[model samples]
Target: MPSMTVRNVPDEVHRAIRVRAAQHGRSVEAEMRHILESAVRPEGRIKLGSLLAEIGRKIRLTDEEIAIFKSVRDTTPARAACFE
Candidate 1:
């Protein structure tokens, strides 16, 4: 495989990438590879909105019910804790 070097990265962006790599228990190179994979890969994964829409479709919820479900999802404990 061919390799390429990315030059002239801003200091803050490099620092942020390093911090994220540490948080994910990955080497900086591995973390950058993961980021690139997510950006370039074509595999389908369940995103939150699409997952919720699928659930709504299965349940055949009314518009109001879907709105309420979205509200509850938005205010979920995990989401709230992430903000704090």
Candidate 2:
């Protein structure tokens, strides 16, 4: 395993990290390692719009219900996708 050192952290930050470490039942060193690992990890999250669109296709709505939904959707303009 490799080694690392962090220096000159503020008192407030150090206190907060200590508190958080205690809350998670971990040593400060272990908590810091976990935080660093998580920062580098890729997040696996689907875009809300794409997820909603997929669900929309699977379910059928009445014309009036769709009209109401469309009216709500119109409030938020969709952003242009990079590929288009």
Candidate 3:
């Protein structure tokens, strides 16, 4: 295991961490670890075209309208394919 030290923390921030840790039945160290994990985790990008299409479908956009949007703002197919 790696040892780490974090300095220059404000008193209020420490109190907030302790409160949150108690709320979740975790020690301050464990809460900090969880926070770090979530903050540092990688995330995938959302496809604008597909997302727009889904939203369009939900809102009952016509096929023609959807096609127009797909044509005008379609991302480069190569970069889009990488997401899948």
Candidate 4:
């Protein structure tokens, strides 16, 4: 696992994190990790596949219509890239 060092946190902010950590029964480091995770990967985030499916539903695409793409799609193997 990777580690991080957060520098120059304000005294009040550090104190607040300590208090919050204690309240949540977690170490200050764990609390910081939780905070960072929540800030970045939020609960209500919309994924690409889900968004595309929602659009298809809104547009009322039938199963047979979607299946037509599979029938027409190329099944060729992709060529690998050469660095040389």
lDDT of each: 0.87, 0.88, 0.88, 0.94
Question: Which scores better on TM-score, 1 or 2?
Answer: 2
Per residue, candidate 1 scores C-alpha lDDT tens digits across 17-82 of 999999999999999999998998877766897897898799899989867866876554563456
Q: lDDT per residue, candidate 4, 6-75, as tens digits?
A: 8999999999999999999999999999999999996789899899889989999999988997799899
TM-scores vs. true structure, each candidate: 0.50, 0.52, 0.50, 0.53
Tens digits of per-residue lDDT, candidate 3, 18-59, equal 999999999999999999988987777588979977887799
Give per-residue lDDT, candidate 3, residue 74: 52
Could you give candidate 2's per-residue lDDT for residues 1-84 as a string of tens digits?
Answer: 999999999999999999999999999999999999889877985689998777877786567877888787656768888985
Clashing residue pairs in candidate 1 (N, C-alpha, C atoms within 3 angstroms): none
* Candidate 1 Cα errors over 4 Å, as ranges: 43-84
The global Cα lDDT (0 to 1) of model 3 is 0.88
Give the TM-score comparing model 3 with the true structure, all chains together: 0.50
In model 2, which runs have C-alpha deviations exceeding 4 angstroms? 45-84
The 10-residue segment of model 4 with minimum total lDDT is: 37-46
